[model samples]
Target: MVDRDIVGGNWIEVPAGKYKKNARTLSHCQLEFNCLYSDLISHAAEGDYSKMAPFRVLSFDIECAGRKGHFPEANHDPVIQIANLVSLQGEDQPFVRNVMTLKSCAPIVGVDVMSFEAEREVLLAWR
Candidate 1:
């Protein structure tokens, strides 16, 4: 269609006059519109290059703490901690290695090993 849809507006019908006057030159233009107000009447324009967006690669490892003096079992053991290594499209080193755990533990000086009181808290924060 010649007229593209704008989301988050509460107008009853298309403002045809406004479109004809203000948006005539927007055809084939790579433009971004943002809602400037809660009612969504006002909009600000910008440019976007989503076509050049790069893919993000994420690497991670799971650590399950088995019962004392026992081997970790996938079927029964609980995941006590999670470690993540995130690499952006062109980073030399994986930028971040974050770890979250259930039980209270000593912190590593430079690592992101955060311990929570309960496993449910970690899962909720991730969600």
Candidate 2:
């Protein structure tokens, strides 16, 4: 068959052998479409390596206070702080940097520090 290149990639039309009428999975969730793995590989798009897309990346860390000699557990341990840093692709400096602490915390240069009275408040604010 001749290859047809669409806007983003080539289009491959395949016959719906069995999944034509009932397109829902066993869990009763209707999917956009279902196809076999071999069918996908046959119609895979060619990669474009000339340019890269710009996107934001977020990196975060969570600090918890747990019992000594024990791994931190969500139900048992209390989250003390949550630090976040968001940077743009191909950028030198991070666009957003902040920290949410359960209690009062020392200020850091170039970072926004948010202190909450309780752990629930801090977690809620982070969400």
Candidate 3:
């Protein structure tokens, strides 16, 4: 389902049109709207962004398992880890940083993480 209606999103000139504020694109989005990238994921997670919706921000990074030099093809590359800071609208400080993995991984200080036996296990745990 479309999380937010595209018609109500903030419009942009470069992308040319209105789009959802916190929408994730599994495929190509419409040409005429502003779609929120990772920069706006926090807004979606908090469910409130009126105070700081205009600024572009960096959230976290995803680490995938593959050869160093050659990028792994779509079916080969596996998403081995994800780390992010989570803060709600009323929270005083963001503290839900975590890194999930599919194998034994070194613990990141001050962050919660666990390694699973299978990739599907990781997805289920994350959800």
How do the residues 8-103 of candidate 1 rate in per-residue lDDT, one tens digit apiece?
A: 432222333333334344444344332223323322232442133455687777677687888889667877777777777877877777788888
Over all chains combined, what TM-score does candidate 2 have? 0.59
Q: Estimate each model's TM-score.
A: 0.49, 0.59, 0.46
CA RMSD of each candidate after superposition: 12.2, 9.3, 12.1
Sort every candidate by TM-score, greatest first. 2, 1, 3
For each candidate, the alpha-carbon lDDT, in order, equals 0.58, 0.76, 0.59
CA lDDT of 95 in candidate 2?
89
- Model 3, 8-124: lDDT tens digits are 444312232434544554544433335544223222323353334443232566777888798866478887776677766656667577777888798778989888888777766
- On the 0 to 100 scale, the lDDT of residue 103 in model 2 is 83
1 or 2, greater by lDDT? 2
Q: Give the alpha carbon lDDT tens digit for every residue of 1-127 in model 2.
A: 2333323534455556733444454543334556554443233454643344577898999999989999999989999999999999989989899999988888899999999999999998887
Query: What pairs collide in candidate 2?
Result: none
Best by TM-score: 2
> Model 3: which ten-residue window has the lowest total lDDT?
38-47
Name the lDDT value of residue 12 in candidate 2: 51
